[model samples]
Target: MLVQKNVPLQGLNSFHIVARAQALAHITSEADVKSLLADPAWASEPKFVLGGGSNIVLTGDVKPLVLKVEVLGRQVVGETAKAVIVEAGAGEDWHAFVAWTLAQGLPGLENMALIPGTVGAAPVQNIGAYGVELQDRFESLDAIDLQTGETFTLNAGQCAFGYRDSVFKHSSSGKQDGGYSPIGLKDRALILRVRFALPKPWKPVLGYADIDKKMAEHCTDQPTAQQLFDWVCEVRHAKLPDPAVIGNAGSFFKNPTVSPEQCTDIIGRDPKVVYYPLPDGSFKLAAGWLIDACGWRGKSVGMAGVYEKQALVLVNRGSVDGPDGATGGEVMTLAKAIQTSVYERFGILLEPEPVVV
Candidate 1:
């Protein structure tokens, strides 16, 4: 039930934006949350769960009570005919968890190696990379209701996973249409732990261009899970700046999806537009290509700058540990400008991926 006041948050978030939490608390276990809820001091206050802090942008000093998730555990929970159930605490580093899975001989999560953030935060964004997504490996999850303090479990379907989105991203208050809830958990729930169903018969997820290049370079068609993990890490390191060094929140925008006709129109204008056909008969335009096409690479707004190597990444050009770091406002300003340019050029509004606080 201990609460710290005026906690510095620049180190917590990947963007390294200068900010602070008015009050912050750590939840290392479910009992901690229960205890906090029972206290009159915090029971009725609005709360925001902070995990690895890799997927958020702090715009200013956070006014809500920041509950920094620090729960920890990892084990093989059970086994099924087709897969094995593995559980990890919400606060566990996502990349480390992936490595742990591989160390235990699990293969499905290898394709998602090196993705920043915590395991609990993964479902909120339905985090994906290369050719695989969290939904593909998710079995179920246990969460606590912030308002009621009741623990509950939900299966994959309840998550309502979409590209870099899930029920967790929406607010609980939404209009009811066709008997379906539009607003989801949002700030009402705190994910305590996540269970993944790793495949029994291991197989590598291939065909991604960067991965293919690795395969071609190695001259090995049949790659192991460890190899895939190494290559994914290599590819990511090459494209994205380390948040520990140059502050960043990975890809700044979601690759916008459009109708086939819309893709055709864009292609007619610029044949070099990078896109991929979805199984749903839609096309996903590379947001990086659009940003690059608009000539935003290496551009800056204040201390915020677009990565010289990848237009998809927005970086903090100033010192992270000092007073000269980029503010969340500057980051958002740059992001909005890029969005405006991409929309004007390609007739598509690129959505930002990071959660803006």
Candidate 2:
């Protein structure tokens, strides 16, 4: 329950933005949250739960009591006819968790390998890659109600998952389904751990051109889960700048989903628009394509730049170890500029993926 004051956050966030938490506390268990809430000085304070810091943008020093989730563990917990249940601490590295699952002969999560962030942060956005999403394998999660300190568990149905979104992303104010039935969690819940139902008879998810190229290179139509994992990691590395070398928060914007008529209109605007049809009949336009079409690739607004290889990723062009690196303001400036350019050209406003704090 020790709350440290003025903690530097440069080493914590993947973006490597220089910022500090006014006061920070680490929680390793449910009891930590309960204890913090029981304290008169901090019980009534607003709080922010921090994890791997791979999916956040810190505009400035954090003012709320930052709860650094450090809870840790992972194991195969149970089995059923259709799947094997696995449990992981919310604080576990998401990529590490995926690798561990594979080491245990679990294969369903391979397509989502190398995604940056913690397991707890995964559901907040229903993280997906190649052809798989977290919701596809999610089972249940244990969390604490920050408002009342009540421990509760939510199954996938109760989670109300959708493309890159979940209950944790919204507030308690009458937010509708797609995220939750009627109540949204947003700053009101703190996840402790999560459970996943890895498919029993694991099947590979493929068909993306990047993956197809990998398959072609290997000269195999039927690829193993490990192969899929390695390909995903390779593709990501080739297209993205590692945060260890360059400051960035993966894909900066979400691929916008558009109606059929809208897609047709965009196609008329540019016949070569990269898009994929969803099972629901809607079309998802590539945000990267839109940005690249706007001629933003390798462009910079101050110290923040659009990744040359992938227009969807805005990067910090400044020295990683220097204080003159891209500020949060500069990153947002570039992101907003990209958003505006895309909207003007295609009538689709690209939504940013990171949680701007």
Candidate 3:
């Protein structure tokens, strides 16, 4: 375990926001985690677990001790004629894992290529892209109980996955009569490792309309997993700003899902509204369409602005003219504006995907 105090978190998070953590610990093994938990210094203090830091936004300096998970390994644990079971450390980079799987001719995860964040955090949000979700390939995950300092294995069902949510995220502080308790800084449980079952023959799934169109345009009758992965990277690169170049999370808000009646009412106002029918008999509206329709694209407030290329992304355009250049971008306010605009335009609420701090 490596420990530091008063660490700058600006570069750690993808958003490039300047924030500080009172203490930060890098854990490379389960034993290291156990040792840290045994320390009296952290006994009652709040704790925060961070991975690649792609899916989080720090509003201000975080008070808790940030534990950076560094445990790393990838192995093919089991194999059959049709499928293979691969286990990856929770701290492994998600995109790196996807590339590795594709290199090994694994069929799944191609659609999730170029996604930021770590493997451990994938199940927390049930990360998805291009019509594929992590839950579809997830087998199980090993998590450490913060209270008992014991590890527990949770199957897919045990994870209680919903769209962009999981038991780890919803029940980080355990369950309550109303629902899962609110997540507290120190009380959140930690993920250790994840197991995925991927197909062996490596058949690609081309469900997304844009991806399919791209493939067809290229005149490729049978696009390999690598080809598909490359295409996804290109698409994402074109649509989303690279956090390294511009400070922004990939997608700020999830596409809102509403009842059929709600969709009808929304479309009754505008006939060209884009929507996708959900399996639950609901309608999922395009959040970007709504934001763009509201004329927020490329709009800026101080240093914060919506990405011109993709309205779903909010960007930080460097320091604003203020004393000490202290006028930092406000993501919450922009998000709230987008949320209110969507609500007013279509009477549907848009929820942010990134964890707000």
- Write down the lDDT of every candidate, Cα atoms only: 0.91, 0.91, 0.81
Candidate number achieving the greatest lDDT relative to the actual structure: 1
Q: What's the distance in Å from true for residue 124, model 1?
A: 0.6
Q: Candidate 2, TM-score vs. the true structure?
A: 0.96
What does candidate 1's lDDT look like per residue over 29-54, in tens digits?
99999999999999999999999888
lDDT measured at residue 303 in model 1 versus the true structure, 0 to 100:
94
Candidate with the larger TM-score of 2 and 3: 2
TM-score of each: 0.97, 0.96, 0.92
lDDT of 3 at 298: 95
Worst 10 residues of 1 by lDDT: 173-182
Which ten contiguous residues of candidate 2 have the minimum total lDDT?
Answer: 173-182
The segments of candidate 1 whose C-alpha lies over 4 angstroms from its true place after superposition are 173-183
